[model samples]
Target: MTTLFDRFERAFMPNYGVPPVALARGEGTRVWDVDGAEYLDFIGGIAVTSLGHAHPALVEAVSTQVATLAHTSNLFLHEPEVKLAERLLALLEQPGKVFLANSGTEANEAALKLAIKYGKTTGRSYFVAAEMGFHGRTLGSLSLTGKPSIRDQFGPFATDVRFVPYGDADALAKAVDENCAAVFLEPTQGEAGVVPPPDGYFAAAREIATRTGALLVADEIQSAIGRTGHWFAHQADGVVPDLLTLAKGLGGGLPIGAVVGFGAAGTIFAKGDHGSTFGGNPISCAAALAVLDNVDLEHVRAVAERLRTGLEGIAHPLLNGVRGRGLWLAAVLTEDRAAQVQTAAQQAGFLVNAVQPDAIRLAPPLVVTPAEIDTFLAAFPAILTEAHHG
Candidate 1:
């Protein structure tokens, strides 16, 4: 019999490689493979499924909106788009203009354009981004990304982006001079094994950007929308970015992205600056609205605390520590055995992400229950043991 993976390998692009298992369905914090093997879901679709799979609110919003009205292109206006933009701005508690897109990369691409336009007006042409930080995989965003391994082959990119050491205030200060158009920072470097910057780093970046007359762009693609126990991760530093990019967990699963430009940055874009065909489509916007409506920040914080505490309490020799905030955590291993650990976890019926060779990222849905967390915590030591020995 031809398996689903065989069919997928035949039909799909090879960028993602062949996945280990073919997922059939999911509910809350659990998923089942095509073979009927069940697993506890901790990755949450790389932090995209904010409400878990088949969530009631997400399902209803998507179903209702798709049935009522779906795509209208940018040529027409829709109520869901307006409502979603308003809600995002409201959550920010700032006056801003929102540009919606289909994914985080698109959001970052839009932000890069805004930075370019700002540069045009200010006579500046360069951007400063953190080393080991990730914005997205698209050309513009990938140029801003500091990882040379993933980005080096695809370039020569068009953007003049400078790389600075992440969490180092002095390096950031030195990089953003008068000729710099923007300074892009991720509140927490998500793709770099969920690494966070030193305290006061964002504040210093804001000060530096202001002094140098550059736009401060926060790429909150992975750390926003209650993932970090805040509306946005930059809130932890109490610094308001000139431009903020958001996605991943924004739509609970359906693809959506947004860029919020505050104050002067909001007005930089002129008519016909940039646009997207599927951006802000009613279905995605409605799904995002449902995510905003149902995501409980307080519960998110509590569960995060429990999970963190449980992780920290484990006395395994292979355990190094934990990184990140709220539900977006990475378990640091003493050895570079994250891939082995991930395979062991799968065999033990749990889903986790080997984000790096030495780190396993855990970004479960906000609605994941205490019991579910406890189940993972209980099985984790054995999983580690199996990985260590196997």
Candidate 2:
């Protein structure tokens, strides 16, 4: 029987190709497809479902907020939006101001705009970024993204943007100069195979930014909101950047993003600089508040650590060591067979993702249990074997 999803796909863009399974409903760490086949969810909607699907707290918060007050334009103030901003500022534990948006890309776009405005005032024109860093899809964010393939099509981009080697502090120091406005980096490169920088790299970057008078921006779209067992991954390094961009799991499942600025950087945009139509709608803010309230930091940390260790125990010739901080783990395989492993795992009633040809990333919901980790570990060897010989 032809499903509604099949009909819907006929008119939608083909950018995502054809989804293998039409997900129907979800609860906690598991989901069922349209035909009602159950599977363990490891991708967690690319780390956006921090509290998992249909979490009662999120559901009730969203339902209540929508019923009470869904949206109020920036022309007026709303309680949920104000409260959510306060909550984020409190969690950051830093004196700062917030500029809310609707997605990570928009948050980065705001950050980029801030950089440009600040640069103009300071007589600086250039910006520096790192290679393999995935910022976002918008033009300004795309300019900062260091992936050649992503940038290739959008040539003649914003000028004076430099790309450097990630985790190479010396190279970064040499790259940023007096004419540079800002330096953007991911605390841990999530899309570039869950690669965490060397110890003290964040401090080194901060020093370089300070020396050059460039604003330091941390893009935590994928690694923030307890995805890596921390409110913000850079907090683990004790380095406070000039600007921080957040999204992904911020709203549990709803769409929301924010750019936080400190001191002078926070006030760069005087007025009429940037604005959004649905940036801080009460509905999204309420959803994000519920996510923050329900995502217990201690529980997330324990589960993430347990799962990280379990992934290291997968025994196979093609298996290499696992690398990541918290639940955001990537299995480094011996060969470029990450795609094969992903397919095998899917066939075995699991949903995993291959961030790169040789790296398999696991970012399950924070609610996943130890028993689920054990199940994954037990099934891992066979998944590897199936991929190796097939």
Candidate 3:
């Protein structure tokens, strides 16, 4: 028999490599393989599935909007898009303008353009970003990303960018100057094993950016949309940013991204500066609205506490400690065994991400049940033991 995975290898690009499992369907925090094996989905499509698989609210919103009006390009106005923009701004408790796109990379690309144009106005050309911080893969966003491993092959990048050590206020202060246009930082470094910045880092960034006349751009793609128990993770530090980029869980499962410009930054873009044809598709906007209305922050906080406490209680030699907040967490290992642990977990009917060689990331749905948490916790120790012994 020609399995789906076999067919996929022949037809698809090799960039993602070949996935071991082919998922056929999902509901809540559970998913089924093409062969009908069930597994608890803790990665949640790399933190994009907010309400879980096939939730009634998400399905209803997507289905209803698609049946009525799927897309209108950017040529026509739609109710869902307008309402979604307003809702996001309201959540921030700030007056801002929103530019919609289709993914996190696009959102960061848009922010990059805005920063460049703003730089022209102030006669500043250089940009500052944190080391190990990931913005996106697009050329514009890629230039701001500090990881050399990913950026090395794609050379001749924008040379005006400066890279500073993440979570170091003195380094950031030294890098940003009156000639700098913007400073990009992530409240939590998602790709770098769910690493969070040191305490008071964001506050210091804000003060430095203000003093140096640089725009503070918060890339909250992975940490926003209630993943960190807040609408935006930087809000926990009580600092307001000039620009914010968001995606991942924003559309609950649909593809959507947004760049929000606050205060004067909101008025930076003039008529016809930038646009996206499928940026604010009606279906995606409706689905995002559903996510916003249905997500219970109080519930998210409680489950996060339960999961964190359970993970910390595990007495295993391989385990070091857990980092990150809310539903976004990484189980740090004492050695480079995350890949083995991920395979062991999958074989034990659980899905996890080997975000780094020594860190396994666990980002479940916002609506993950206590029962699901208990099941994963109970099975985790055995899975770790198997990986350790192997």
Candidate 4:
């Protein structure tokens, strides 16, 4: 049948390839494809759907806010915007200034620009980012991304970015000096196989940055917003970074991102340094506020605990170790069969992702019920068998 998706692919650039399934509707952790086939969604829109697809709270907030006030220029303030900023600040557990944008890449772009501006004053032009880190896809953020494959053709990127091995405190200390502007790391490396850093790595990085007068930046775009069972993954290490970039789940499936500058870091950018037109639109703020209100930290933590226990009980040779904090977990599969596993799981009425060749990442909606977990557990062995030997 000639469908809307087919028409879309015929006209649009073939950048992401053709999507296999065209999703039409969703409720909680389940989504219906255009063919009306239901599947248990575990990818959660690549971790963007915090409370899950079409959550009631998010629907109510977005619907009401859109009807009342969809957008007001940044020149004038709105109540929801003010309230969202305050709420994020409170959740961050820090005093800072926020610059809002429409995506993680944009947020990182603003942050990189801010770092460069601050570096200009300090007479240091170089910034360091960790290896295998996925910041974003824009020029500035792309330059900061540590993966060479993603940066291959986009070069002459915002220059002076140094790539350092992730979780290596000594390497960061060796690279960071008075001449360095900032050191950026993802508390939990999301796109690179859900890699968790070594213990005390972030804290040690903070100490190194302090000693060297370089700003410490944590790109928590994927690991923040209760994804790792914590408001921010860095909280587990008890270290606060100078600059933090947030997105992904911040807008509850809407488009929004934020660059939060802490303490002295906030003062680096003077007036007119950075701005965005649709960064903090009232509708986006309302959706984010609804996400915040629906997710309690304690409840999310409990959900993580339940998932960990359930996954541990499911046995398979390919399933080595499940690594992650909260809902952001990666099931370690043997070799490069992760893609096959994702395919098998999907065909078996579940949705999953192969974020890496050797790992399957599962960032299910926070609203996923215990029964959903049980369903996955029960069907896991067959999925693995099909993936391994199909």
| TM-score, predicted candidate 2 vs. hidden true structure | 0.98
Per-residue lDDT tens digits of candidate 4, residues 300-327?
7777788788788778878887887788
List model 2 lDDT by residue over 1-390, tens digit each.
Answer: 887677868978997777777899999989998778888999999999988889999999999999998877788888898898899889999989999999999999999999999999999999999999999988999999989987879877966789999999999999999999999999999889999999999999999999889999999999998887788999999999999999989988899999999878889998788999899988899899999888877887888777777777667898998998888999999999999999999889889998999999999988888898888888888998998898
- Residue 173, candidate 2: Cα error in Å is 0.6
* Backbone clashes (count) for model 1: 0
Q: How many collisions between residues are there in candidate 3? A: 0
lDDT of 3 at 73: 98
Query: What local lDDT score does residue 361 receive in model 1, on the 0 to 100 scale?
Result: 98
**What shift in Å separates residue 162 of candidate 3 from its native position after superposition?**
1.1
Candidate 3, lDDT over the whole model? 0.94
| Residue ranges of candidate 3 with Cα displaced over 4 Å | none
Off by over 4 Å in 1: none
Candidate 1 local lDDT, 271-322, one digit each (tens):
8999999999999999999999999999999999999999999999889999
TM-scores, in order shown? Answer: 0.99, 0.98, 0.99, 0.97
How far out, in Å, is residue 45 in model 2?
A: 0.6
At residue 70, what lDDT does model 3 achieve?
93
The Cα error of candidate 1 at residue 232, in Å, is 0.8
- What lDDT score belongs to each candidate, Candidate 1 first? 0.94, 0.90, 0.94, 0.88
Q: What is the Cα-based TM-score of model 1?
A: 0.99
